[model samples]
Target: MITDPQGTVLALFLIFCRIGGCVMAMPGFSSARIPMQIRLFMAAALSLAILPVLWDTVYPTVHTSSATYIGFIFSELLIGLMYGMLARLYTLGLQFAASIIGMMIGYSQPGAADIFEDAPESSLSGFITFAGMMILFMMDFHHIVFRALVDSYTAMPFGGVMQMRATLISFTDTLSSTTYIMLRLCSPFLIYGLMFNVAIGFINKLAPQMPVYFISAPYLLLGGLFLFYFSVAALVSQFGQSFASVFIGR
Candidate 1:
């Protein structure tokens, strides 16, 4: 049963290259808080689990010359990176939207430690980002990503030449879509901030001696927080619902 052990090891390594590349860039799995050793083990375990399903496709490709094998290694890594970055970029868009929301709503206080990543973010932004990520996890977004990886072998068979143009196009499309979605999620706050500022400006001009800026700060923060509390559930719900369309549609 252990015949061609060398070939099996080679094939497994080939699989590991791609999966490891993905884990290196995937959002939750790639967080700075996660130990490198744990990431390596996860990648290796996934590779072993997937090898049987992809044996026919991967095993044949492992017998090539050393130079070709090296090329395959790079190619597979890039392909996996592309896939992982797709999701990473989308989540990053949520972070960007969170920052915007925090700034708009007068919640631009000092940055706090992010619950998921090591990066510092505003308290409001950190909470929003954590909530969005939690929703994704609850919905099993990782399973969707893994399913996409399995489907990728058919779309991009092993040893195929990497398509640079298509990869760039995919990244571009993901960014564009993410921007639109994030903007939509935060549009209400944008409008609220703009109108509130305009009203405060008028009041300030009318009562220049009263220090309207000081008076309005509390109101701005209060209204923003209230708006956010009422709308946050819907905002995060839409974000979670849109993941499949954005990630899988492309």
Candidate 2:
């Protein structure tokens, strides 16, 4: 049993490369708030847990020339990254929508955050983004992704050529679908902002001396916040449902 210890270790590492790559880009796990060491440990543990289930299929594939083995490792990492990006990109849509929501609702000022990010966001935007992420986690989105990852080997075997056309189609479809969802979620605010701004513009035109811009700011903020309070639950629930269909559905 111990005769091929090196081979067994190599196989396990190959498995790790895939799972590790996924964890590297997955939400929450990949967030700046989470420590790097913890993510690595989680990936390693999951790989070992998965190794037994995939042993028969994985073990034999690794006994190859060193060059081919390296290629397999790269492919495995690539596949994992592809899956991770599929989930990550969809989740990121919520953040993208948040910025639009904040601007539409007259909350365009940026806020402070403990974690680092490239894009600046308003307080409302940050809150919505954080809330959406929490809801996704509570809905077990990660569980769905990981389960799909396990089943991927069946659909896409190791040491096999990657399906470029199919992969590109899926990636493109996900991008388009995510954008549609983001816009749909923010459409109400867009309409509200447009109508409110138009009405304010007319008032200013009617009374040239009136400070309509300053006068309407408070009302805009209040109405937007009120709308958010009433509709946030529905928005998050819809997001969860749509996300499940995207990754978990056939």
Candidate 3:
């Protein structure tokens, strides 16, 4: 019984390499707020669950040699990272766009520690990022991620070639798609900021003696906040829809 214990362990280890890499890079799951121990456990548990389903595809292809095994592990890790990074890139765009919106609307008064990320983000930026991530979780986004992880073996096959060119293309496409979506999400704020600022400029030109910068800053901040209050539902809803399309379709 268990005549090939070493092979079984090695097979599981290889599976862990890929799943662990994906877990460590995926958004929300990878957030600093989540303990590393939890993430490692999640990856290990996921690998165990997926191993049997992929046993024939993976176990046969695995090698016992230490050097060959190491190579396979790295390659598998790379593929997982590519898949995980695709989603991370999409969410990161929202964070970036939030910052742009805050700055454009004169709301970047101060920065606060982000609940998920290590960087200091404007309060609104941090809020939007957290809300979007929460909405994603409620939508069961991780189920899709894990489903794709399982399917990746079929798409790329176990120990298949890494197709560096296609990976590069994927990376580029994620970046471009992220930029386009973020721009669309924040365009309203951009327009509001521009029109409001221009009107303020005209007022300043008419009454140069009055302290426009001081006078207008409060109004600018107030208007942006008011607009955000009314528009946040639409913004969050549209963002969630777009995220689902990109995450699932990509």
Residue pairs in clash, model 1: none
Worst 10 residues of 3 by lDDT: 241-250
How do the residues 1-250 of candidate 2 rate in per-residue lDDT, one tens digit apiece? Answer: 5678988899999899889989988877888878889999999999999998999889998789999999999999988888888898888898888878888788857566623254556677777777888888888999988988899898889789778887898788888888999899989989999999999999999998999978999899889988888888888888888997776543
lDDT (10s digit) by residue, model 3, range 1-250? 6667878888998899888888888999999989999999999999999888988887886665778778898999998898889889988998988988898778866778988978888889988888888888887878888888888888777777788998898788778888998898899889999998899899998988998889888888888889888887887777777866776566
Candidate 1 structure quality by residue, lDDT tens digits, 138-158:
999988988898888888888
Q: List the residue pairs that clash in candidate 2.
A: none
Error of 3 at 135 (Å): 0.2
TM-score of 3: 0.95
Off by over 4 Å in 2: 1-3, 114-119
- List the candidate 3 regions with Cα displacement exceeding 4 Å: 1-3
Clashes counted in candidate 1 amount to 0
Task: State the displacement of the C-alpha of residue 213, model 1, in Å, after optimal TM-score superposition.
Answer: 1.6
Cα distance off (Å), candidate 3, residue 89? 0.7
Highest TM-score among the candidates is held by which one? 1
Judge candidate 1 at residue 248 and give its lDDT: 97
